[model samples]
Target: MIDTARPPSVDPHMSSALLLAAAVAFAAPADDLDLTPGAWPMFRGPNGVGVGADPLPADLIRPENLRWQVDVPGRGWGSPVVADGPEGPTVYVPTATPDGTQMDVLAYDLATGEERWVRKLFTVAEPDFTHPTNTYASCTPVATRDVVFVHFGKYGTAALDTKNGHTLWERRDFECDHFRGPASSPLLVQFDGLSPRLIVPFDGVGEDDQYVVALDAATGETLWRTGRDPEVQDVVPDLRKAYGTPVLAEVGDRTLVVTTGAIATDFLDPATGERVWRVKHGGMNSGSAPQVLQSPLGVASDAVLVTTGDAPTSLALLATDSDLTQTKGAAASDPALAWSSNAGAPKRATPLLLSLGQAVTVDDGGVASMVALGSDVDGDGGEVLSRVRLGDSYWSSPVRAGGTIFTFGKEGAATTLETGVFRGGADAPPELKVAHKSTLDEGVWATPALVGGGLVLRTEHTLRFYHPDGTNE
Candidate 1:
């Protein structure tokens, strides 16, 4: 027998009660910085770690504590970064026009919800192919104490003054097909200690093939150029999974140029285009950027970490030595599968590897799992100690803050989970905990950008400021 519970009755006589059963899905923005102490300046908050260093309460507010939620124009998946020049900390958002008529990046004030500045900088000569989920501003802006850098293929790269929305320098001459639009976020590296280099890459094929360009930070002039063998494509190669930006890490006397291909991971000399080593982790459709881990087996050894996947298997960590370019390294350090789980790692959201080398991921299924980076073999490989299945998929990577991990799904559900996962090589997995959550419309895909005082949260059409506890001013 099937028993179906039904509504008993309506308050027919007792005057009709009017109410709005609020229904926007909740997607929690990261509280990675302090609303009273500091601000998130670039891609991964302050440094490129994708972590908010805020000491606020882990419990973020819902409709109650919300300072204010305001709707803006344009649509894209790029997170906002604050450039504190003279006008305090101004939030910068690079948005793309839907019909391709114009592609602009805008700025806002963190203190009160207000439009600080709008810069209609790039106009695509001809828009390139991109994934349904990606946008022109997919690449988050990079900043220094005085400049903000944004990359727009065909349209070129540009640098803006932090004080006023003045063009510091602009480079609208580079040419490369951003097959699936551009998602590689620019990284800032200090030249001597003050000078910065804006490293950005683009696609090309065959003899006149793919390339990664480096521009002088202060001035958007072409400082140097490095090229790669064109990815042999039968067709235009749906470049979506093929390209990525460059991330830096010191290895020996040189910094590494770990660049993601439509499907390949290559290491290049930052000073020169010399590819020091190369490793191919299958699947061309790469969404997130690559992360490096020191030889997990121990310290003092030579090893690097890489993750790839889209429709197929997603998370993978490849430990390689110098032989990777040769047949030996590839054969010897065959990727030791760390943790494989289909917990909804987004096809567009990059996977964030924590300091422990363990993967902190939010899968396409709206499920977030903190899988330990296992060193053990098959029979007892590794384990995903902590996980919480959410109700949506987030193209934005979760920002780590206050011992908790924060991620937002498609509908805008912000899930806060206690990180620190442990494999039960001897004990049991940890319990799942929900720190906070909030609601929003469809486009909160941009990863949370920690800013002055509060964390900046945005949808394609709306932007907001969230305090740690559920309090909205």
Candidate 2:
């Protein structure tokens, strides 16, 4: 149950009647959960590419642009997800107690900041050791027309009917050591035009027990399982763990599931969970995900970009000589080396590949740099396009919206930069132009969500909605 009785402590407040109406509207059953075109369904936008074309304001620093802000309970790094229903839209966010013993999910009205519903899912008797920076609620929720899936890594994974506050299914038997904490989020992928499968990365703390598990999205049953056996042994056991999510890419007639792990990146058949090809990288415990590059026409290319973990993090491009459909064997049919670069690779935040033949990488220390892509970037052709120092540390990945990349630091400052297009060689390298800078004045580690021409940013204690017109309910 949600506390609909109280008046929401929103900054730059609105009328009480409007908030009450919005809260009451949440009682209606969700007829549909399918995300509309302007809705943000999951992490990094719909496709996890970090590109959002929402019509948010160019400058959030403008006091008139912030619509409303509401305080959230507990601590979490998981981003908010928006799902459209028959009435309007609802934003779902998950968080947990500071002790990592109690986990809960909260629903809010997208328009008025009304408390919709709150559901508690788990209570651990003896929680595992997690890094001080990481919380128990680090995995984001994934939603569709019928169901909303919430995952807390090793704690449990559950499905809640978005229409009502009903727990449809729960799976708590999945085991993993996580070493630091659960940072990987759940991803949904469809196979053979059947029901979609929920993919969860269960990379354990040691080499002997890492696996990629897929569960039936409808029933929460085991759909398929793929184990990762990286033969490389490291002195540190945590180096064998990975906190990265998997991305699905279509290669010609074949669909490949590309995932970066502790010591290597593997491409697998999404249907059968069979490894197609793999490239070994010496870096251990990768935290960033692999991004499948797309052509200017938005077509999937054969090249995939990945970032290695540990110190001196490096970025590598793996391009297949032939169609991936015709490839078999992990190491036998490995792709040719396109190139590897160590310039400004983020250890936790995933990189974004723009349509302008450039990839944006933001390091934890706030160094944002654009590198020229394609097979030519590996050679001595001056790949580094431009770099900007934002003077803030960032833990969340940046999102592209309204032709601007919004990079939010951990301490709540957001830097907006224009994404200039890069045509080809001999052209002046694209510069990272600073468009605007704003601060939520709190801590922000979760990736922001853009939906319905609005930008939703979550700080350590508040969720703020920003729009171009600064319309507040």
Candidate 3:
């Protein structure tokens, strides 16, 4: 149920004012520096690591604390993105009908949950088939002050004017099968002296037909395209597909984009789409996005960590070495592999990299594990610090805010734990203490958006906002 009572702190007429102001400023482009402090502007916030400075409500299960809950028109699995607007703040998400024919991008006023605009951008006569768990609107929207980009896999990809909800450009030339449906989300990379580019992976089931494409963000022109050949072993060919999103990592003074495909993970130069290094993992069809671990002092490690997809899931760690970095071939037998653990690898949700040098992962079965990065310790890397069971099943990825780690299950339950100690010696075990628990009526599959001292969570049929006390503002 939703609380109809209006809060005294916010004006009810603010929604209309926000819409008007947003319309006037739709022509200007937004950058990372333009985002508000609490804004979550991308897939995993700005950095794509699911970390925020503000804390969520300790008890979101309480109905009274829910600020508002409004029914959504269609189904979607993509997470919402928040940005600062002219009047206040705005939220954007993509949804589609049950038949996968109609695709729409909806924008809402962050203050009152008022629908600002809905743009019916594309309609497919013969839509591709998707798995029962996936929806037609699975890809999340990427937004800036000037425009918002929405992608429906091979169906279509378009840029919409942020102010009036108008289509700026459209592209449908990319060839991809998306055997079980597309899951990779589009990413934006801003360059210093060049136009900003949108990067997305096209790893479909193929023999030699995979590509990592980069497009000019302003005009939707192809800037560069590079091939990706995982050379997967003989198995179900459909398993040769991947549904993971690419992430940006800072290595020394250079920046690289790290992407996981069917049978391997590759690091490429963001500007030219050149391969920096490649590491082969045994699994096929990787769904979890790769995470670059950071040390306690805030330095990013050269090694990247990810969970290999499919049965008998394993966690693989790949680091840059002179020999492997110099060669363009796959590093299946490279000596830079720190460790491989098969304990609790997730197939869908992305892992959380902690500031305390611990990597927290939640598998599809709702089992959570904390592993030490071994940067400060003397033991072999990839040691399990601790483990716990949160729920029966989970699809939403875990996030960190303030000093707490939040995990959500598919059955509407959420667990809050205090970040475990990161400086424990090799002999001491890492531990995360449970602090609070909460729940909702509908199940969750999308990651929640946190900003403006509040949280925006999307269930199967509703979008709800909450205060820190789990109460409506």
> Which candidate has the highest lDDT of all?
2
Local lDDT at 323 for model 2: 40
Q: How does candidate 2 fare on TM-score?
A: 0.86
What alpha-carbon RMSD in Å does predicted model 3 have with respect to the real structure?
10.7
| lDDT, each prediction | 0.59, 0.72, 0.71
After superposing candidate 2 on the true structure, give the runs of residues whose Cα lies further than 4 Å from its correct spot. 1-38, 232-235, 297-301, 321-333, 377-382, 421-426
**TM per prediction:** 0.78, 0.86, 0.85
Question: In model 1, where do residues sit more than 4 Å from their true spots?
Answer: 1-39, 125-131, 191-195, 204-209, 230-236, 239-243, 294-304, 320-346, 355-357, 375-383, 420-426, 469-473
Candidate 3, residues 1-473, lDDT tens digits: the string is 11213221221223544423322232345443232222676777776788876866556446776777778788889888877655457788888997888888988877788888899877888888888899888787777765677787877777777666787667776678787777778777764544476778877775643677776676565666777754553546677788777888776556778888777888877777767666777676676778876444242345678777875477877755334333424343332555667766788888888766678888899888887665421226677778877875888888877777777778887787775445576556658666787776778889887776777888888887766555434
Kindly list the per-residue Cα lDDT of model 2 for residues 1-473, writing each as its tens digit.
11223332231222444333322121223333442322677788776788776545558546687777788999998898888744458788899998899999987778887787789888998888878988999888886655678999889888776766568667776667888888788778764444466778877675555778766565566656677765744546767777777887765566777887777888876555667777776576576668886555232346778887775478877765354323423343456446677887788888877777788888889999887765442343216788889867988888887577888898877888876634455566667878888776786898888876778888888887777778664
What's each prediction's clash count? Answer: 35, 2, 6
**Candidate 2 — what's its lDDT?**
0.72
Best by TM-score: 2
TM-score, cand. 1: 0.78
